[model samples]
Target: MAGEDEIEGRNREDEQMHYNSTNLSSDWPFNATNDLTNTSMAMVASSNPMNNASCSSASMIDSFCQTPPTIWDHHPTNSQTLGAFSDLNMQNNPTTSSSSLGFRKGNLLTPSWPPPNSAIKRGGMFLPPPTATPTMLPHTLSQFPADSGFIERAARLSSFSAGNFEDMINPFGNVPESSMSPYNNRPVQGQPQEGFVNGFKSTSGEGSKDLPLPVDCGTNDGSQPKNDARQGGSGFSGNNLPGESEYSEGGAGGGGGQDETSDEGLGSKKRRRSDQDSDYNQVKRSPQTPNESTKNNTEIQQKGDKNPISVANKSKHGKQISQSSDGQKEEYIHVRARRGQATNSHSLAERVRREKISERMKFLQDLVPGCSKVTGKAVMLDEIINYVQSLQRQVEFLSMKLATVNPRMDFNIEGLLAKDMGVSGTLGFGADMAMAYTQNPSQLAIMQGGIPGLGSSSSDAVRRTINSHLMAIGGVYKDPNSQVPNSWDDELHNIVQMGLNPSSTQNLGSTTPSHLKAEP
Candidate 1:
């Protein structure tokens, strides 16, 4: 009976120990298999009545209790099973517990899952929740059988979450460098890694020394450079290297490439410039040797003879003067100089353009019939304006006149003038009669009374009336006394005789009048 009681007590102690070990192992990072094996051993020891009587069970129990728990146990179960168990535990306890050996707040034990979509706001991503309760998996099961589908799904979720998290953290990492700003130091696509050139380092052997250093050319405070005085008050002396001659010639020819010297030169600089000019003059004035002068004269003559107009144009654009230099005659083209005044290239261009416009204006002035010949630009412009206005008014008046004219009339004033001026044979009588009426209407009155036919008498009455109307409108008439018989009477007699002669009117049959007989 005492043995039975001892056995019961031992069993109770073993059960308590098993329970404690299980709790400890679960709390620890160790797997469930190790805890289950330990519980099985304790149960086996407690179940044996001989071990309890001999004290082996207590010793064995002590040994089992003394064994340290490992983070992961090398169980006899399949690796896939262990992996699944580990994964489930990780999911349940994302963060280590306080009782865990190296556990600390904010420290992550397992790979983190992605935050919910609500974490993103505006253009920026919001911070994730401070703490998250991991979803717990089953712990009672000693071994977990692997599920290929679940494993694959979990893997895909992990990868997708990881990639999304990476993108959120460093969004520009996958973008092409070319799409980035020029100021960004990211490497360009298709460019070799080693081909990058550092702006700080120079390509020349002298390095930075070979680089052109920026000089203090001028200041905004109106303070000039210290060396400006030495350079004859010029900011840079190099500008004058082309010399004054080039500047003068370029200005006249209206060509580019003229160097504009600084206008801030001192009085001493002006004196030096004058001295140079005098020296140039002296050099130009010296007489040439006979042979050289003859050769030069012959060349000039040949060139002048070839194209006199070209020489004349050059002289017109700019004055070319023959000067003797170093005992040799030299010709220098003289051009107007601005002299110490800063001139813009645009101003030079504008001047040339104005000159061309002036030439064109002159040509137009010559063509215009009574445009008041004027020299002043303002006066000429006023004349041109007035002339254009007058022409416009004339055009309006002529258009109104043409509109009022009878459209039924086929007669053209120009055609009439042309016909009258052309042949003087078959149509000569009509032309001559028209001219006679135009020149003197009084002459028509004299010819009217001379006609014998009834048609002629009626025509004479119409002519007298027309003449009287023309005289009323201030028409000029030649004096009857001033008219020479040879000029008027002879032509009229010939015309009358030609019309009256029988032989000349052979085609006129018997209807021809005998009272209109010629007095030959």
Candidate 2:
């Protein structure tokens, strides 16, 4: 009986040890899940039962025990199940406890499944190895792919010095060496490009209906233009500008070539621009010389040359311009002749002279009174002469009168002329003379009208002569009869009467003495 008890104890110990080993192995990387691992361990234990008593005891215990939570459970099985198993297993074997191994608070809440190094095999498919969480990083230019062309261009640009700035910005086809080398067969800086020249010819025959007609800007020197046979391939260079010869030549060649090609079933002359051509164009924007300017201008004019009518019109227009310019340098009135008038040079000269003379006569008529209505040139001349003679007589008479009135010559002539002469009364002249002269004998010749007929200059000579005669007459002539003669009074009265008549001024050469006659 004691031997049977020993065997049963040994069987119970083996069962407890197997249960602990299975629980520990469930946490191993090789296990699929806790449930599958526990099921396999239960089958092994059931297959290896060595004692019936021990097996009966284990069966009774297994019947009372609940299943442990698996790794696949999103939330662990309730802690109440673990709490119930905790009391039975905590005392003897803590490693086999569900709470301590699979259902720990930290493991259940934040479970990391399928370790990073392991692959998950579910059904027929195998999952890729678990990856670590991704992290963000700052971006940089180096992270992108590099372009060789762009890099080389940048390096070349950085290498340029201040001295080469002109080369960089040059706009007349003076491209830099680096930019020009790649495009084969491009023309040099001062030379015209073959492609451009060919293109010019191709387009020349194709009439530019949309473009405006070019203006004729003739050469600086007015010399006649000479034809360049080399420029006009067809040997027709009529009045072309300096560089237009080449343009004409190109147009003739292109037109003939195009015609021949079309007749022979050859291809068209059109060409597509390649990369090299485009690059060349970009580099060809530099400045050009005078020769190049002429070439370009020729190209521009070629399109207009196709139409013979237009060429003829241009030639006609050019001739008109030259004629007009020549006319500008000469001195000639642009006078148009009337139907009845002569257009001869002599007639024109005579008419111009007559016009000048008529203008002078008009001016003279304004100066001379009563001559404005006179139309005849001879009559106007006669009136002008008479008027001048009258002015001369009036001047002479006035000078003589002044000499008599101012014997001292020191009297203020300006003050005397400003006051009224008061010559209407019979005694007016005598009263004025008496007041002016202090009994001076120098005034006697003037009052008696004894001055000689020495012409218009006689008054000036008499005035100067009177200045030398300063002798004073002491006594006044008390006899009024002696002061002025009866003949003198009669003469003075007649002179005054004639002067008062406005009509007497028309003929100063009338019978009345001119010197004695007061100016009308």
Candidate 3:
């Protein structure tokens, strides 16, 4: 019934052509066969219920369908070969769905890249299809919901299922023997006996002498994708193309039911691939699936991959003295060699600089979320405390180092009322020492927990430890007098009022500040 409808549509067209036998062929390269085929396809499409009403009305004037035929064999009385189709009214009359007409029209000339949405760029920006580009609002492709929908749909279709992937990634079935199969025995130079075979270089099982020239191969040339023979293969010979036998088959069977398969397959391939966004993935980098980054990192670690060689070497060097240490002795054995002391005074000073670089590296490592196992809590806290303490120690070390260099600088530290130590505490260093320590008191307290007090022996001892810790961190000399300077009482009025006496405290029950030695 469907085939009759198509035939009837063509008969109607031929009936009209009988009127004048118009030489549409003169203006168009397409001949009667082409016209007949187009008319049939258009009519078949118009038979759809959606197209009936429009085609019914349009059936009257459309030159391709309704115009009475002009002379098919001769030029029409009209001189202009194209004049027959110049009936723009007739052109507008064949009211089949514009979508179908457009598709046919576009594919009529040549099957092209899928519409912009379907035709994904192999490796560049996603251009809205040629059709859509002209109509699209000026914006990024992501701005279009329609394009996104097509992208998702294409992704859905193209996503290879495990089974499909098995097909694509591994075309031949099970492959223990594909590379060394019997087909590969291309023995040289003779049509060997029935059971014999030729190996790779031979043109046939008979071992022909001529070998075809090599062509561009893929990442896995001889080893993979033999199924993509259309793209070319390492060993396939042109003997595969049919010559005499093909024509004989066509003459005998009128083109095998299967012979048409090539054309049909090509057509189907075009139609299948013409979807909107076929090359979308090609143009874009394949995004890692969720969890992919973590998975890849985990796999690498499990495989025991190490840092690049140079990096591995540097790490080994840093760890060498410790790794080779016998017990903690040599490892903790702080080298007291003063070779670099002028540049960086103490053993501790050099260690602190190394620690700072290590801490920064840890910070960088923590930037990647799942890539690291470190929470950084303990390490970070230790780094902060250690850094602050080092700054404090460096301040004190400079003071002592300067005392040896210049003595005048101490005056600025706390207005040293009496010249205590000169030559060692020269005019030059006193000011520098004070600026280093007391000028930034807030910073000092934040480092040491609080300022050093001078009330009792225990209080003095605590002050000494704080300064000792500072000197250790900074790689400087710990003063034997790490205690708060005994002159604290004389230097500040507040300290004097607080009193070094220690006697008034226990008996204060009867005396508040109000009851103290009134007015002098």
Q: Which digits, one per residue and each the tens of the lDDT, describe model 3 over residues 1-520?
A: 2223223223322322321122222212222233343344344433543234233323322322311111111111111222233232212222222222222222211223332211111000111111221112122122222322222222332222221211211211111121112121111001111001111111110010010101101111211111111111111111111212322332312112111111111111111112211231121113322242223223322322111110111223213312321132222122321222221123345666777877886775565443245456566555556666777999999988978755654323321111121111211223343344456566434323221222222533433443343345334433423322332212223222333233222112112122112201
Deviation in Å, model 3, residue 7 alpha carbon: 41
lDDT of 2: 0.26
Off by over 4 Å in 1: 1-342, 368-375, 406-408, 411-520
| Best candidate according to TM-score | 1
Return the lDDT, model 1, position 43.
Answer: 35
After superposition on all CA atoms, what RMSD does each candidate show versus the true structure? 40.4, 45.0, 30.1
lDDT of 3 at 368: 40
Relative to the true structure, candidate 1 has a C-alpha RMSD (angstroms) of 40.4
- The TM-scores, one per candidate, come to 0.21, 0.18, 0.15
Q: Show the colliding residue pairs in model 2.
A: 171-285, 171-286, 171-287, 172-286, 172-287, 173-286, 231-245
